[model samples]
Target chain A: MKINRREFVKRMSAGAAVTALAGCMSNAGRPAAGRVVVIGAGYAGATAAKYIRLWAPDIDVTLVERDAEFISCPLSNLVLGGSKTIRDMTVGYGGLAKYGVKLMRDDAVAVDPVKREVRLASGASLQYDRLVVAPGVDVQYDTLPGLASADAQSKVLHAWKAGAQTVALRKQLETMRDGGVYAVHIPKAPYRCPPGPYERACQVAHYFKTAKPKSKVLILDANEDVVSKKGLFMAAWNGPYKGIVEYRPNSELEDVDASTLTAKLQFGSVNADVLNVIPPQRAGNIALVTGLITANNRWCGVNWQTMESIKVPGVHVLGDATLSAQLMPKSGHMANQHAKVCAAAIIAMIKHEPVNQEPMMVNTCYSFIDDKNVVHVASVHAYDASEKTMLPIKGAGGLSDKANELEGTYALSWAKNIWADMLG
Target chain B: MAVAVGCPLNAHAQDANSIRGMAATCANCHGTEGRSAGTVPGLAGVDKTQIVQQMQDFKTGKRASTIMQQLARGFTDAQIEQIAAWFSAQKK
Candidate 1:
């Protein structure tokens, strides 16, 4: 952002000349009015990029994503349930074009905070007045030594990222015999989507109910109990899938015997027809490599009001990569909210306007117990100026009373709306 | 000597942007600017009073809801009014 006046003027496009010139009047050293570079095209980054441009048409936004299309991890569990497909979850970046966001199909290999630049794998460097990084999570294969090898990873799928792995896991289920056992190991807390593993168990169970009734669904949870929508998930497991679904708490996986299809625990090992090992996770590799992570060496700490990285100025972190605030789940919905707050704040900062002081965010996560029944957990968070972080509003958010078919209809609509909100 | 080309946003513009931020949060389930893609009801161009009343009903549990009852409690009455007004201004 610290560029010579001539260089700044030269870089500004013809359409942006007016704003760029206006920016130069107040301060000789100020960055050109609106040059933002956003990395990752997931819920957070895509929304941030699009909203920034939508709100301020003059602002220049360049979104760098390694993948050509966005594969939503939100409804990916449905693919395993045989209710949805990978094609259903996939969305293209083509929508962003109408909003004037420049799309770069390349990996963000490194970020230079000092230089205010992002270096892509294509050997191109993007200079930015501000940087937004929403890299999501990095599934740590290293944490599970047994699953570190490529062969082991292929045999014991994670399917946490919601693309190829999701389809691969579904294929495995399709191939399993009618009486086969499918076991999934849940990692410790502070990972993306606490309710996700439980939902997956339901989806797999639903698939088994109609497709392979004799099949068993085993959940080996590392935590002492279910992490999210616990009561609702418990009701589903005990009610509809009583004999088919088995829940084991505090079953921390020691390692995996991929070849033997065994999950090694502290006391014993459980063998299954298929094993899914969701390894421990941390902030995505880009966040880690760029030294954006400040909390427990896992997540990037941020100023909640602006979503700006506390550790690095001129760089904002969003979505699952961030150290979530109190009661904030790392969800696509929450990330979309983060993107808006961050977008509004960044726009204000560039315009030298007062940022929104009392920002609020809400999270609503729905989980489908079966193909027809769904439940949800909701929370409302507002900034507490005194505390310097967002706190869940007392008596504001709560869980659903019960799982019902009505919620299932709403859940799908919610997905469609949110996808359009971020991509459309 | 400095040249003033694209001037900074005025106070009115800033206020408008701030409210837009709050309203945009609802877009996750409601649709961008309240234009829903399907099933869920759209909020754009609705009467401000109607929107406020509906939010109040959800907050008070007078209107049965699967999720709104929980989400509506998150916003203050004043914030709800602002969001309602913003959505009322959006094109249907």
Candidate 2:
């Protein structure tokens, strides 16, 4: 059970020995003191991975991600407005490597906690003393028939996965016929970004107003009104893109005929020259398969302070995968923040340390309604031990009842500062 | 420049001293040991690698943090190891 440091170091450089040691590390978890394996390289996973390495460099750390570069969805909408490109949103993982983290460019397919192993699509198994799962959100395209995620490439572009999907969607918008109709479908609640579809609509309308005057945008929102960042969205859509943007609230898109470029809606069909669909989403399929989500359509349930799965031990869920009634729509910013909360818990457990009795969590979501203005929603969290819930600080940080130039300016500054805090 | 004498993180119990010093600095705004005064943050219980990496990022300019970079730039490799050691061992 004793692994000499020299032997461990010797084994680490050699690939076969690394794997062997990794296996041995899994089986030798006598008292939960060793390497921690983090799956998913999104805000959640990346946040967890970096924290583990920072807290315990002596303990081995490995990050598993399918993509080499991460394109942030936060500032991505500006890409559609011609102010930014996907390249502007892209980030490298070299920061993690510099911290001595092992990067595995492979998809994690499954995990067996009993065996303390994470099986990847590459047929490699990663051993962990403690496992942190931060895979982020997964779209359930099947929620809407004839309009799956694959539809992004052929007819309607979701462009939510970043990389090629984002670029393809941009190209689709770029080559779209001038003065032609462009459409966006807002899915049901708890999607990746609450104000994303609307911000996207505004960005498109910005393009159309300048490039294609005759073109109009039709936004079919499944909800009664804009969800997150409501004031800012209404201000932009109503003030800036007012006449050009046709917003249909509480009207869901029932069907899509990609060939003819038409969307059938509860209200009526809207024919379009180009279509962008943000489909209904839930926790990642990996979470669903692992029973992290419930039949109530909520993601994993957990003790708000610890973020440990109420149903499973040695497994913690963060990001869009958990049901935190305290927070607003799931955003990468929130996910990253939540991952830190969970990380704090994990580090404590390794040394048999007592956790803080009351936990405080925070998250902010920024929406770029237009070039001149951006708005943000923020909140402070308090974990209630009795209720097993994380509640907001009532008057702390929420959207403005009336967004003005001052609010907009503050939001812009807040975003710049927050991004610096999270990804900076 | 000579190292700050009477620095809270003295030679005795280097690990705890470094951890408390790091936490105290962050707590100036983030609250004690990573907890915040509502606006800043609570670093009491966060990812260890992420915290250290973020500090590293701020120090190297990979990420932007005026105060954090200033704070991070002051730490040496041994300090970082000690800081990570103390904070990661904290409970949420």
What value does DockQ give for candidate 1? Answer: 0.52
Predictions' DockQ, in order: 0.52, 0.05
For model 2 chain A, give the 10-residue run with minimal summed lDDT. A23-32
Which runs of model 1 end up more than 4 angstroms from their true locations?
A1-32, B1-10
Per-residue CA lDDT of model 1 for A221-291, tens digit only, reads 99999999989999999999889999999999998989999999998999999899888889999999899
Q: Candidate 2, after superposition: displacement of residue A158 in Å?
A: 1.2
Lowest summed lDDT across 10 adjacent residues in model 1 chain A is found at A23-32
Docking class of 2: incorrect
Worst 10 residues of 2 chain B by lDDT: B1-10
In model 1, the clashing pairs are A21-B5, A22-B5, A22-B6
Number of clashing pairs per prediction, in order = 3, 25
Q: What is the C-alpha RMSD of each candidate to the true structure, in Å?
A: 5.4, 10.6
Per-chain TM-score of chain A in candidate 2 equals 0.87
